[model samples]
Target: MTKVTDVVLNLIKIKGQKKEEAANTNERPPAKKQSPGELRLHKDIAELNLPKNTKVTFPNGKDDLMNIEVTLRPDEGYYVGGIFVFSFHVPHAYPHEPSKVRFITHPNIDLEGNVCLNILREDWKPVLNINTIIYGLNLLFIQPNHEDPLNHDAAVVLRDDPQKFQRDVQAAMLGGYVGQVYFPRCK
Candidate 1:
């Protein structure tokens, strides 16, 4: 049973020798090892097999895969015919941790980019995959769960008056005024 101190000292010695070797060779150190988060992202991207309407893009270009943008174009629902974009940021823990997701363009999204979804919050589990999350996000546009909502006003309207809520969603998606708020045309 090696003591913690002994293990740390051994690691330091190895790192020091590696640094010296790199210095002598006039070579850069290897890229920082990918964290669990990065490894999961690589796997998610490869296995995505996204729907035709959905596209994933690395905004920082190919090398920076930790951050990505997912575009969703739902075929049906209040958001139908409109394009929605969501940004995903994978933390160092990756599959061990849920990816942070924000809506870039959605009628219901607040200015702060807070997204309302069960899987991204209380329902998250290691067994749930990217496909599940993406589908849940699309459901947000289609269903817009007004019961558990980050936007209280939207939820209130949705609960109190279903027709008006649908109208408001349509107006917002069409780049019209649902009141003082002006939503850009997403179609």
Candidate 2:
């Protein structure tokens, strides 16, 4: 009986070791989570040079630094007196990947808030930071770039008839319908 008990214990130990090895082989140790971007972001935030009419807020609370809201109130140009809201989502990749940005839905902004601007798309470079983004958003209102516009109709109107484009912008900002599309008042 003693010999049988010893053999049983040895078999149990072998089975346990095999199970441990299987789990270890199947499960990889998680990669070390290093966030160099978070530190850089803190520095960028400290040195933020936003225009006078632009303001940034974190709706998810100050503790949640990953997401931010930028409100641009361009004092000049066609979009003057209108308030534009944009959201910035900083990804884990940081400076390596550009922060994702979206604006409140408007003629310029699709339903997904994907506002088309050079910096957010083709013009984006790792060197650009939050400050540059603010400037870009400001430029969107100060001067609507028709050549590479996201809103094709708006761009055509702006290119062909500047006055009519201004009227459409005004109407849209005043919560009216422009060509059957209803825009909420953002002025």
Candidate 3:
């Protein structure tokens, strides 16, 4: 009876070991988890319907969805034929928090790339998506808001003298010096 019990126990152990090995061989490595913000951004980007003059690109490739670059080429505005690129860094608290946008060649944008768009700052809401921000940026080129500006001097000029403002914008777009700052040719 002792010999028979020992044989049965050894059989059980061998079966268990075989099952464990099979399970290990069939299992795959765990997939990396995506944060809620990444999930939301993925949805937003997948559903993007960009405007005719606006295009969005990922400098870090599609694998990294947090950083984005938006290029605008307005066809009928002060910035017509000019190319402007804005970088957007979406935070982990996106939607709840606004994206950080940086672009350096507009009346409402400073030389240091500080933007003064209402939706980007005080008026931002969770309901707004990337498309909303793109439209807002496009509108800025179409109709620059001198009332709220990051470049006060440019705003003042736009407000006080429309023609001079247009000339200055043209000059800047053509890679000329505006005041002490030189602008690169974006056209």
Which candidate number would show the highest lDDT if scored against the true structure?
Answer: 3
lDDT of 2 by residue, 12-117 (tens): 9999999889879989764555477766677778899989999999999976677889998889988899988888998877777778888643345665678786
Stretches > 4 Å off in candidate 2: 1-34, 104-108
Clash pairs, candidate 3, are none
TM-score of candidate 1 versus the correct structure, residues matched by position:
0.77
lDDT of 1 at 186: 77
- Global lDDT of each candidate: 0.77, 0.81, 0.91
Best by TM-score: 3
- Local error of candidate 3 at residue 17 (angstroms): 12
Model with the higher lDDT, candidate 1 or 2: 2
TM per candidate comes to: 0.77, 0.77, 0.85
Arrange candidates by lDDT, descending. Answer: 3, 2, 1
- Tens digits of lDDT, candidate 3, 1-187: 9999999999999999998888789896545798888888999999898999999999999888899999999988788999999999998888888899999978899989988889999899988988899999999999999998999999999999999999999999999898889999998
**lDDT for each residue of candidate 1 in 1-187, tens digit (9 for 90 to 100):** 5799899999999999998997879877666787777777788778887777788889999889978888999888777888878898877776767778886334346656778776777778877767777877877877877667776777788889988887887787778777676777877
User: At residue 133, what lDDT does model 2 achieve?
Assistant: 82
- Report the Cα lDDT for residue 73, model 2: 88
